[model samples]
Target: MSFIPVNEPLLNGNEKKYLAECIDTGWISSEGPFIQRFEKEFAESVGRKYAIAVSNGTAALDAAVEALGLAPGDEVILPTFTIISCISQIVRAGLVPVLVDSDPVTWNMDVTQVEAKISPRTKAIMAVHIYGLPIDMAPLLDIARRYGLKVIEDAAEMHGQTYHGRPCGSFGDISIFSFYPNKHITTGEGGMIVTNDDHLASECRSLRNLCFQPHKRFVHERLGWNLRMTNLQAALGVAQLERLPEFVQRKRQMGALYQSGLAGVSGLQLPLASTSYAENIYWVFGVILDASVPFDAEEAMRRLGKMGIGTRPFFWSMHEQPVFQKMGLFCGERHPVSENMSRRGFYVPSGLGLTQEQQETVIDAVRTIMDS
Candidate 1:
């Protein structure tokens, strides 16, 4: 059999058509029409009043952090189980990043632990929706409200997901989405920061455009990086946004097929299909080795690779990261669930472009590898 990669992006909508339009019009820069259209439409879709497009998800984070006006040495509590982008911006902004472990079942940050981590220096809570599931946002939001802390929601993996009938992106003071190929909607490499706050939205717009002064043409007051998204990327984003509904439906169907196919498979722990508030969108169909399994995620991925299958390991706990450890962060800290997940978890081939046949091949290969 041919090699089955982990994530094959789907771009069968108006992507080519839009790209052609961009090419023919010679409007390929950040000033193109699609930029504002994508931003406006995306903001409306997510129930946000404004959206500022940026170069990538990390840039979106960087912009969100600065726009919120978090001062240096302020603390931001975030999950240790999330991508480095979540904490990296916090650290880069000279803010303290406090760690919390993952909920073993949902693999999201343990909302209960968040309050305990809060200190007088804590200024915000960064709630990251992991994989396909929105974090337990209601409680997290409540925690933020009670503490008067801002919430920077990382909805990168959740495009159309909801929590208790509320949209995922709408919960935070500022929410971010990524348009990487693997996401439900792809802009090749782009991201957006959305919020209802007018001042914050203005701040983010300025931040992504190098903090250019509105009145002065060539002057800088405070520092900001150029992380502007191009018209070409926005053109792709506009097309993908049009098909988000159908794409989400397809993702659910694929997740159902995988769950049904792999049910009762021994020594593998599947992602929870749903919580009381939200059904997983299955951004990626992840599996965790039962502690009883003899090998770790690396070994499992190695075996899958040999079987012509592709897999990706789960995020290593930020608390235990070498970079953070060297900085004397999370020192002597032990988050058992996050550490165990990093070792035992890996996601199989789950992408918006996945086909039934390819999914079946992945399933069979997973069984072959795990049953061995």
Candidate 2:
């Protein structure tokens, strides 16, 4: 049997047609019809006023931070249980990162803990929808409104997720999505930043292209980087955008299969679905091993690989990493819940195109390993 992957991108015939057209027209560069169509279509899909395509998710984060007009030493609050890009962009923008602990069940940033971290130096909050789950954003948004702080939603792993009937991207002052090959959708290696604020959108568009002015050649308005997405990538994105609704539905079905299959397993706790008027596009069907479980995430992954089942551990806690420790960034910061989760959490095979037979094989392998 072949090794089952944790996540895989599904490319249909529509994507191939668009790619061929882009290649034939020799319009595979930055500016083209596909780029415009993708931005417009994607923004409309997520209920955002504007969406700017970029090179990758990290670049999207950098653009969001730059648009905030944050001064040096201003802090951006975010969960410690997240990828490096979340914190890297904050540091890149010359802002401090106030890392917070996550709730054990939801594996999301604790809203109760966010208020204490806000100070005069606090500028914004970067809420990352960890794994495939949407963070509790209603209370977070209320806090943001009360404190007059910005919210940057890292919706890279959560393309089709929503919160309280509103989409995840719409909740933040600015939100970003990744179209990497393994995400909910793919455009090879592309990203997007969504915003309703016209001024911020204008700034983001300018900054992505070296802040070029229309009137003058070689004119630069501000110091910026080359973060533009290619027309070819956008071509693929446009095709994928049209099929998002169906893809989200398939993803949910896969999640249900995993829950039903693994419900009786003693050592593993499946992800809990949010019923707060929001739907999640289970990007990765993650499971948390109980403390009494015989193995940690790494050991379980090794055993699963032996059974031809591919698995991946959760993101390493940013505050506990060596790079952060050497920088004296969070030497005394303690997030025991997220720290422990990093060791025990792992995701099984859950892709958009997963079949029932494939799911059964994975579930049987996990049961066999745990039952031993």
Q: Candidate 2: which stretches are off by over 4 Å?
A: none
lDDT of 1 by residue, 254-285 (tens): 99999999999999889999999999999989
Q: Which is the leading candidate under lDDT?
A: 1
Q: Which stretches of candidate 1 lie over 4 Å from their true place?
A: none
lDDT of 1: 0.91
Best by TM-score: 1
Backbone clash count, each prediction separately: 0, 0
What C-alpha lDDT values do all the predictions have? 0.91, 0.88
Worst 10 residues of 1 by lDDT: 209-218
